[model samples]
Target: MASSFAYDILSNKIETRSAKAGVIGLGYVGLPLAIAIARSGFAVTGFDIDPKKIVSLDAQHSYIDAVANDDLATEMDGGRFSATTDFAGLAACDVIVICVPTPLTKHRDPDLSFVEATSRSIAEHLRAGQLVVLESTTYPGTTDDVVKVILEKTGLKSGTDFFVGFSPEREDPGNQHYHTATIPKVVAGDGPQALALMKGFYGAVVKTVVPVSSNATAEAVKLTENIFRSVNIALVNELKTVYAAMGVDVWEVIEAAKTKPFGYMPFYPGPGLGGHCIPIDPFYLTWKSREYELPTRFIELAGEINSAMPRYVVGKLAEALDMRSGKALSRSRVLVLGLAYKKNVADIRESPSLRLMEIIEERGGKADYHDPHVGEIPSTREYQHLKGRKSVDLTQELLDACDAVLVATDHDNLDYALIANSARLIVDTRNVFARLRLSADHIVKA
Candidate 1:
């Protein structure tokens, strides 16, 4: 069949919402997206290497907090969506979207291992009619320079024999305001046919489809949005420390500053950067920029400042415990409130609370955490030794047993009033006790 005929056929399928969609790496970004595509009337097949996730999805169970059980079950019951660990299924897909993770390397460089592996697998199954889109957050030129080269090995030219595009994932876990279907999608493709087919596919699923000039533009857009957040968060985190030394309340200051209708946007300080995007995406650019012999000063500085937050939060706990009960952090029994980076989400990727625990344990502190979302702290590339650490329950008895409580994550499910009146020593990093009348020596905003 001619490539033009294949493109026209894929376009017709997308227009009719009958395109067979295949999603790779069904994690936070991929799972919700697969559901959205299935709901759009496409027979979506999700591809993940993990057998556990494949089984769960096949059984109508959702492991991601953003995807509800009912939503997953609806698609499975209708036979619109299914999951598999097989890469051979890619041969049947008209639209294949890659949503793999682009994490940082051990030395803080951009790690493209997952993306490279996915591209290799897709290359083996490179069919002429397939429109392959990368939704992973990565450096520019990755689709053209990296992925394009791999797929061409199958003797088919991108934009000639097959279609390719770049679309970044914008998934915010626990955010009820926007989701996969509502969040506007940005797409850029290798050529005209690739762009049109990509737009038609996402246009069916999302509320709006934003078309950009090139694949690099779509890739850069994701990095730019995340870098802005990283820099702003670094600014406020630095200010939090400077203002704290001046005996000024930074949280209160931010509450007043955000009242201005123009010229200012508020980004609060936390224990540190958590989640997949904020802490990791900017470095993708940083690694790429180095090849051009240019430096990213703001990104490097932000990482330094944000990375120091765990130690800074731990120091505050030490100070609070000593001043309140003349106890050292080494001997003190400290309880961390939440482990997830964001509230109401079970995702603990690069969570600062885990870093807080790591630092405390290094300093001889008896560290334990209590989070409604996470019962046991799972290991990551950074903290492998923290595995199997179960969450401790928060209670009057538990509070009395602990020498100090560190409010690392202020999950809304927790009763702050009960914790405020009962705890003897509290280091509220999130300002959870800001409205409460805490004693001069009992509570300190870290």
Candidate 2:
């Protein structure tokens, strides 16, 4: 009876678009989700610990690329969206979504500190008739084990007093074709009432809501998606090494192999895996599987291959410099082109370009970078020393001064023609020059 009454109140609010939604951790995932909920007619309060983000949002400025300034202005101007740092306001919200970071610790273990901390804050203001959903990617049991355990500590039963659900966030930062609203959302809950509320809430916000059997199933769905990519990418990266030895171009091989169209999907090789998902998500499962005494050999192997790519690219760069210019890398200057993990956006989470730069500097080489998207390097857990470094101006004079120009990221806006014409030696890791049909002796494929 308690569950039914609580469900009725929240369900009606969701249906009528009167439910106040609170999204915690306004970042690449939380910010866009908050805007989407606001756009769908819900009054949304965005909660973040960062005061700078609050200041930016108050000024109608957007830090994420997917959200435009005009859209933010429209939402704020309409009084549908607001940002704050206070947890007391959380008590007023009917629905609370957790979208905090779930990064791995230094030991490659699951770091649930952000999620746990967010849960504790919510628990401080948690009340009856409120729904809490976790969108941070993690192991299958996190929704039930970590989040639910923390929330239930308030002496309130989960299904009867409140609700719990899991819906993994599938955010692609630079994807032009897909956005928060268009992507299909996979949702699951702790019980029937929770599931109904999840379906009602997410159904109104996104285009499609896929209901799964359990919260753990929804969690596994996200892990599987990223693991599939990680394994395939490792396969290609290993193939690149084997094919390079036999005078075979892995890019050409992938371009032709993809022509089959029926049995194959192409995954390209890079300096290494970047972004928050591929490099990190697979390890969440690897860490969880240890409880069951299972060996995730394939996933571990894929991680090794992807992690080794930066060093491999550096080795190739050293080889190219010695063969082409007869100069050892220790006494040479190299310009790294592009800094963001992928092309066209300014997301640098777990970017391999940082590792490449670190390795270059460790080997006694002077390294500088130029990125159109990233103006300066921000503080990161792994690459703290590279912080405050600014992007250099890409000019003929700058290019001419370097011993070798290493192509790390393949952004479309870069002046490849200027690079081909000006740089004395080019070691292409992304095949950007060949893709443009530009041929020169100085440009060597790594």
Q: Which candidate should be chosen as best, given TM-score against the real structure?
A: 2
The Cα local distance difference test for each model comes to 0.90, 0.95
Cα lDDT of candidate 1 equals: 0.90
Off by over 4 Å in 2: 1-3
Per-residue alpha-carbon lDDT of candidate 2 for residues 1-446, written as tens digits (9 for 90 to 100): 24477888999999999999999999999999999999999999999999999999999999999999999999999999999999899999999999999999999999999999999999999999999999999999999999999999999889988999999999999999999999999999998889999999999999999999899999999999999999999999999999999999999999999999698999999899999999999999999999999999999999999999999999999999999889999999999998999999999999999999999999999999999999999999999999999999999889978999999999989999999989999989898999999879999887
lDDT for model 2, on a 0 to 1 scale?
A: 0.95
lDDT of 2 at 142: 96
- TM per prediction: 0.98, 0.99
Write candidate 1's Cα lDDT for 174-266 as tens digits.
998999999999999998889998888998899999999899999999999999999999999999999999999899999999999999999
Error of 2 at 174 (Å): 0.8
Residue 444's lDDT in candidate 2: 83
